[model samples]
Target chain A: MVTAALKEDLPGAGREISIEAVSHRFDLEGAPLPVLDDVSFTIEPGSFVALLGPSGCGKSTLLRLIAGLDHPASGAIRVDGAQVGAPDPSRILVFQDPTLFPWRTVRANVALGLEAQGTLKTEGHRIDAAINLVGLQGFDKAYPHQLSGGMAQRVALARALVNQPNVLLLDEPLGKLDSLTRLAMQTELVRLWQQSGLTAVLVTHDVEEALYLAQRVIVFGPRPAQVVADLTVDLPYPRHRGHPRIAELRHEALRHLGLEASW
Target chain B: MASIELPLEAGRAPAPVQGWTLLAALPWFAAVAVLLLVPDLTYQPLGRELALIWGAVGGVLTLLGLFGNRLGRVGRWSALRGPWLFAIGAASVLWTVVTAKTGWLPQPFFPTPQAMLEVFLYDYGKILHSAAFSIWLLAKGFFFGAIAGFLIGVGMGWSRAVSYWATPLLRYIGPLPATAWLPLAFFIFPSSGSASVFLIAFSTAFPVAVLTWSGIAAVNRDYYEIARTLGASPLFLIVKVAIPSALPHVFVGLFMGLSTSFAVLVVAEMLGVEAGLGWYLQWAQGWAAYANMYAALFVMAAMCSGLITLLFRIRDRVLVWQKGVVRW
Candidate 1:
């Protein structure tokens, strides 16, 4: 049943996302705190891009704007040439915390997007396939509190992919995991993105993680963020961790974030 | 081989000691002995009744002590067995000595335990009828109050405009006791029964509304944002996300409301209602039927505790995830 749903391709599954001159600000105690400053970037369909920055650099805010969870103070976000005004199932955001509804079981949490769109009855098998895709087949009945941090994040990934979203906006989705689990999940993430062929924008503070996974790494400057550097990771799939190229890219990313590149 | 044997030994249950079990039964025996040896100073003829009750209690205690270890994981009662037995026996003996023998407390006001028991045996029909009526009124009031409170709470929490208008009204009216409006309620309603139900409902509604509103309002913003990105409709957000997340608080409200409703139920019933535990209490008080009043009070305590225990069980089932997160 799950295989059939996996084989069934969504219509316009890999639509491109374009953000043109998008800017956003927050009102902090009667003062306007600008977060994003005319941030413009275009992601081709099925590409994995990482938005790397220091803490409080507004990278997460950019992802939120693209997700249509919040609107930009100026400029617009478009998906496949259509202006984005509201949150849609076609683009789902995975947060730093798994944020799986505590009351729901693993299967129910994965089925949330389908249930929200009212297509759960027809696309029910997709939920199973997505859970299977994330390697959570035997944990369908388990509640969120029962899961480990890494397992919970996997469920979150399954929840986003179950919708077969054209673009998956991730905000440090694995930032809370231990080092070993984080490394394992990095591989799992790359595999899921490769299999689904969906565009992904990951926001993270980790330099090596960005270099290890994303096809293109876009570095942002400090608060009132703007794109400071854009580097292409030409390293082959399953890139060697100890490789000099990865180290070089890490140094470059660190330099962009105004940190001293020790190595 | 030695290591495996060590693990096996660790897994095995500790041997049950019989001495503690025997010691636990001693208190119950003492209670029965006290009942048999002591004579009643008052000419109430409560001697046989006290002996019967204490003997039955001792028999039950002895049985429990003998087989408690066989109950396995649920044998927690065995841990405190001796202390519990001693406490119950001491309390029973003290109560009997004071009320029936010594008569330290005066008659009529402090009736013997046997007098209360006689009320249970003879006047049970009346007591039972009154309990039924009270429970019926409670069910009606609670159902209406809970539903109305939940809906209004959801509305106030979800919408700024609703909160803006309703909060002030709630603030002004909610703190006032439910019984305070009894005079007005009696005049407006068609019957005393309706008025009693209204008072119970009104008392219950405030806490439920206030708590539910706060619970909904306090829901993590991340959940709403995440749900929104997943294309959840407004209705789905409320019914699925908001309500479920706020349930722990709703239960808190329900608990507070339940206690308040019970309080209001008694007061409301005392206001010329033809039948109910509260009305029975009033009637008993008028004729100085102290024994009957004690019986009714005991019944009321048991019923209220039973209702509370039932609510806790339901909360445990529905909010199962909150088991380790929040402690009652």
Candidate 2:
């Protein structure tokens, strides 16, 4: 579904997004419009990638295709060497809102994905383990209304993780948080990712956050967004906020987007 | 410097057993005392037999109240609480016993306690049978109406086609009072007793249906969304989310429906049936047996209070999770 949306945005010709074929027309059309005219990328298993672009750019559209939430009108798409069609448990998507079931307790909400997959006979064990994983111990019976923003989102993370998905798709999951909570969540997310060895793809406009967490940051241009640059941050785990190499990479990525680089 | 001492558990006062117990008995004891004085003080054609019986019952209760238990005790055997209830019960008996003794009070007035107790003791077997019969009718109407209304209301709310087609007809038919359908029910059913039950059942069902539909519609949209996103099947969504979510409102409907059914059953029995409490009251009123009419009326009041209490207990038990949880 995501690939199809990306392909539809590509407009003019059926060229792969990274290749240069800006203008081509269907039968009687006179003008050729470019919206992601050509774009291509490959993501390795067990890798964390951030697709950062300005608003109205097709970066989100691209991630949707990769998540198998949408189909490409014309493009090749594969995950783990198999074609992506429908939403599978292997590729789980988490949205910005926690979307926890209000009626269910925190433990029940966290165990929901597993329940859907019919693996809920072990629900008792899984729920406690997941709640502990997200540092939400002693809150198993708390309702969603009783939780803080960060805590509620932790339940959502636990929900996604309980599915045991190979690929974790985050569509601006922390975009709605206050700055303090967002920073805390980012640190938590990185720690969880490191411990779990889960492959993650985050779609965010927060370039600093992107540079901080992801190993590879793919920059997309303004409109008809294609990969404008690919910068690799080779910082060690538990990266320092004021590291010179991190600052340089942020500057380079911002330079590509025509923005000042200083934090 | 003197050590300042604060009493632990300050302002945690003890329960007022004596006060409540005294308040409870005062009304009944006063009524009985008034009845006992009536024959000697008044020149009315007061029934001598009735006054004697009521005075005896009152004396027994006053004695129990005086010596049965302590004023400050809280248990059932405690003097204060037990006397208050005893006084009230004794007073009710005194009023029924004295109804025939006084012409100052209108016809159908409560008899003096003695007269009511005599009638109760002599005909207790018949009274119990008829009271039991009426209660059975009420239970049947309440259960049938509530269940039918709830299930159909859920159907109407859940299905657009059903709501569009059925609601208009229900609205039209529901407005016509259940009493209005009695003549038809009597004609269709083989017996008047069955007809009264049907009328009560049908009348009770309408409010239940309306309430159930409204309750189901009131469930949060987010619940449905979560269920859908979680890939819940249609059956799971309805049974797990929709029904439980709608239950609180549905219970209100059930209570209302049960009350309506009980009230309608009395009317139905008074009009057509000959065996229920309603019939007994009607029978006594027609014969100018004012004392029996009062007795039956008292029985009916007791039944209504008991049924309402029972329904409330059930509601409390079912919605126990909602205790202390505030919702708008």
Best by TM-score: 1
Per-residue lDDT of A1-263 in model 1, one digit per residue for the tens? 54444656433367788889988999999999999999898988889999999989999999988888889999999999999989988888999999999999999999998998899999898887888888998999999988999999999999998888999999999999999999999998887777777888899999989999999999999989999999999988877788999898888888878886565
On the 0 to 100 scale, the lDDT of residue B317 in model 1 is: 95
Candidate 2's error at A9, in angstroms? 40
Q: Model 2, which residues run further than 4 Å from truth?
A: A1-44, A48-103, A114-117, A122-124, A141-151, A167-183, A201-236, A239-263, B1-32, B40-103, B190-201
Model 2 per-residue lDDT tens digits across residues B283-313: 8778876667778888888888898888889
Q: Candidate 1 versus the native: TM-score? A: 0.92
TM-scores, all models, native as reference: 0.92, 0.71
Q: Please state the CAPRI-style docking class of candidate 2.
A: incorrect
Writing each residue's lDDT as its tens digit, candidate 1 over B1-328 gives 4234566668897446434555666665676676677776666645577677777767655665666657764344654566766677777777777887788878869888778778888899999999999999998998889888888899999999999999999999999999999989989999999998888888888989999999999999999998899999999999999999999999999999999999999988887578899999999999999999999998999889999999999999999888656675
